[model samples]
Target: MAHPKEVAGFKLGKLLIEGKTKQVFDLPEETGHCILINKDRITAGDGVKAHDMEGKAAISNQTNAKVFEILKAAGIPTAFVKIASPVAFISKKCDMVPIEWVTRRLATGSFLKRNPGVPEGYRFTPPKQETFFKDDANHDPQWSEEQIVSAKFTFNGLVIGQDEVDYMRNVTILVFEILEKAWGLRDCALIDMKIEFGVDADGKILLADVIDSDSWRLWPSGDKRLMVDKQVYRNLSTVTAADLDTVKRNFAWVKDQLDHLRPKVHHKVVIIMGSAADVEHCQKIGKAAKKFGLDVDMRVTSAHKATEETLHIMKQYEDTHGALVFIAVAGRSNGLGPVLSGNTSYPVINCPPPSSNLVQDIWSSLSLPSGLGCATVIYPDSAAVMAAQIIGVQDYIVWARIRFNQLEMAASLRVADKKVRNLSIE
Candidate 1:
């Protein structure tokens, strides 16, 4: 149901191909971009049952646009460009990957079928990742990493391998985790979701395809009775007009909630160094904090030499702001962390400048008087991470940043472990 203007924007060249859910159009003027027209039709069980609810194309377009927009903002690599119309959007032209990457938080659906004896609501700690061959004729059988690596599949002129599979899994989990935290603030649990990837002309695999209400089972407050996703449509005994309308309403509700789900950017992190000598150390923390989307302010003030000035600085920061954490940087006989911790109600972390007597410097921070709680860190980045965690307790974006950091480390370990195991072959 594309509007005349929308069709005019995409149909200038030729219709590339049409799938069950969308139509791919080739754009001769743009070498690396194409237009994707989302269809209103939806199906479950590998197209066994199908329905074409009215106005679904626009609803799905809205949802996919919001999902892709947020993913791009979160620094996730994707193939989304911009929404072209109410039912269409422009995206990077890529050879689509024939695999579906799935991530799950709860043991339900097909998971229980495969792993019997597992409880329905049993949670996955880091979320379970799975891959399946996208074969509608064969019911999309699950595939292991070994199978994916060994199978012969080429996308965007790049062949699949162990590294490719590993990267896809990593990106899939990242997308899930970031969006999961986003939804968590809306009092919804992202039970499970799947996404497809595509290799661009430059051979970089990116998150692609549509992610709307059809992508995941979103249980509000972790209750299945309040589920709002394609599952609601799947659960219907027999599709009818009323049931289709209910599904349409649920999809709209899910799309409407996305606008308010992202965490607010009001939280701020301030780093105060006692002297100019510690400015370098404070900057390191501030830089790393900014990488994780933390709004950081660096200031130099001494709690011992300029106690009044330091208090003024803290007071100025908290004059109107409430969600803020402080990191104090002072070297020997550190009084900055203690003074800030004692005076302020906000969290204060000690990231003292390095010294020859390192143990003593750390002890100065660790050994605080009763009721004074200023956390200590040896390195600058860790100090930033600690402060993020403290603020993340209440800020969802900060929490997601910390989670992405963990995933980055996990990714490194995974690659290293694979290399270590294949040392004999090398």
Candidate 2:
């Protein structure tokens, strides 16, 4: 083994090479590990326009660490190790894939250039996927999936085949979605992005390379005019030191917002039903709540028949510490909601079980006596959503889940609308 060398106070094995904005170092003690040092520089227009912005490298490293950590937590395979320092991090060493996987959720930029007829904001339902060969001298020309599959490229003892290309395609789309959801929590649109994969020593493909400010176009609040990504720095006509500082500040804000999306609340949702018959209704809410990280407890006690038992259920839960919201599941002459609402000060919501008497059931829950304070909702999804929204008030994770759900629903609609609106008569 080579004698360990020191770089930026850390003992690294050997200096491999340096890119335009980062340097790679081999790790002496850790086998198959390498350190990546992000530089305090920003570049665009094929490196013709560049700036050594103060505080950019540390901030980029922070952003990459935050994003990669979230991806790893979501079960996505990556080559990321923890941040080694403010400007560097350790990662599994892998042979690089010679292509970039780009996913676009909207029609803009080069997407418009390639497909001239499409308008801006033209949405891609599942998002449009493209591959670009990593040949900077040849301008990194876009390649089709067929060309990618046909090319026999080997990296780290792994051969690129149709199956390999397909797997990368699927994984790349998944990466885009994971980051898209993360950004959606901050009310930002991840319009499009590019990612590169690498084959590790064990012949497994991992999402490798540094995804920092330069990797994507982000439209905060879904407005291009409010864009706060590397594109902002790229589009500057005449660069000034202040312009670099301004762009650095935008990057700082993104990293700061990412810090707050992680919620640490022990909020619980209690689902109480009037009878065994309403068990299905309560479970519907429970299952849906589970998807959004809500802890649900189901209790069967008739507010009309076994009033004492219902009160006991409430008492049992009230003693537990944390934010609690009660959902009353009952139908026809509904008394469960009001009983729970009057007994406990926790937020009470009424979600009536379905039956032929649905109208009467809705009316019963909706027309609660003047001071009862129980809210009424019609569908199981709505009931679950209402509970989530109430919980989201204090839990950033819950709020993020809600926002991501909303973005998905809206994105689905855009896909369906595009299909109907763009169909050509053949």
Candidate 3:
């Protein structure tokens, strides 16, 4: 049955489209955006055994929003913007391609069916990806690269190319790896999952589609010994009330675990400088640090004038448990960057303010008078990003965010170009 046409904050206009779980509506007044509403229904086996799972819409809406937010923060390419409410979200509309891309780390289900000789527990060392064109009658036939290319689907006025396919393929793996690592940290095994892509106004492809309980296989404790995913519910020989209850309970468990999920940060720092006059220069370095998920403090200090004071402050940070990236800001025969780099074994970056008259600030940081090894950065954000990058080597959370950032930038450019073309035509 179609929903009552009324949802929170969203006045359902003409129905734009309907999927398995969501209904899209036209938001003509809302410039550059549209809304999707989650319904309290679940389907499996191509809607063969459809059922109404109460409270499911709310749970899924929250869970999808949270996951999308994290993915966006981590700089992943996705079609999610923000959650409007438990039942809705405001997002940029894109022309979705009718393909379900599945990435697997272990042999299961269809893999078992297709490759009968392969053992059930066999693991794919590098993971595998497969695409299926969405056709209900044919049950979404498996598609090869040639098939996808031949389909010739155009989105936002741009023809899909091999580069786009390759990019998505690589990204699919990275997304899975990031999520797998994250869930592992929480003692959950992300067995496998599927993701879909949509072309935005600029012919830019994004990681689109609703990823919820229906999207993946999850087994807590790495022990597929006790699996808890939709498949478990589907494999039930008979659908008894008790069986339904167990499935509901499992779904609820997944939702609860997701509610408590938090990305882990491994390092934090405050990049104190020596003077307020150099704030602009320091900010450049700080921006760079932020990319790596590093926390930077841009403060000014003078080792010569405030040697004792500076040491005292540094000592306090040293006592704390996390690694620090300090960028000493100084100019004209600068000594700050070198001084800090020498005093502490921590990774110190020297970012001396550029002075037109002296032209020696660069040297002050670059020359590094002795055994001191503090790296130098010209811009504050660049310096910050560098620090974060170095720290991120061992931090998955930061690494994931950095990767996501790159994807978002690419998507934005693609979206922009699409809009420009559309406007020109109009």
Best by lDDT: 1
Candidate 3 lDDT, 52-108, residue by residue in tens: 777778777877787777667667768888888777887777888888888998888
Which ranges of candidate 3 are over 4 A from the true structure? 121-126, 264-267, 274-277, 291-293, 320-323, 330-335, 342-345, 354-373, 376-382, 393-395, 405-426
- lDDT (Cα) of model 2: 0.84
Could you tell which candidate, 2 or 3, scores higher by TM-score? Answer: 3
For model 1, residues 240-330, the per-residue Cα lDDT tens digits are 9999998999999988999987777578899898888877888899999987778888898888899999999999988767688999888
Task: Please list the C-alpha lDDT of all candidates, in the order they appear.
Answer: 0.85, 0.84, 0.75
Q: What tens-digit string does per-residue lDDT give for candidate 2 at 92-149?
A: 9988889999999999888899899999999999989999998867878999888887
Better candidate number, 1 or 2, judged by lDDT: 1
Could you tell which candidate, 1 or 2, scores higher by TM-score? Answer: 1
- Displacement of residue 58 (Cα, Å) in model 2 is 0.4
What's the CA error at residue 380 for candidate 1, in Å? 2.9
Q: What is the lDDT of residue 206 in candidate 2?
A: 91
Give the best candidate by TM-score.
1
TM-score of each: 0.86, 0.66, 0.84
RMSD of each: 3.4, 9.2, 4.5
lDDT of 1 at 203: 85
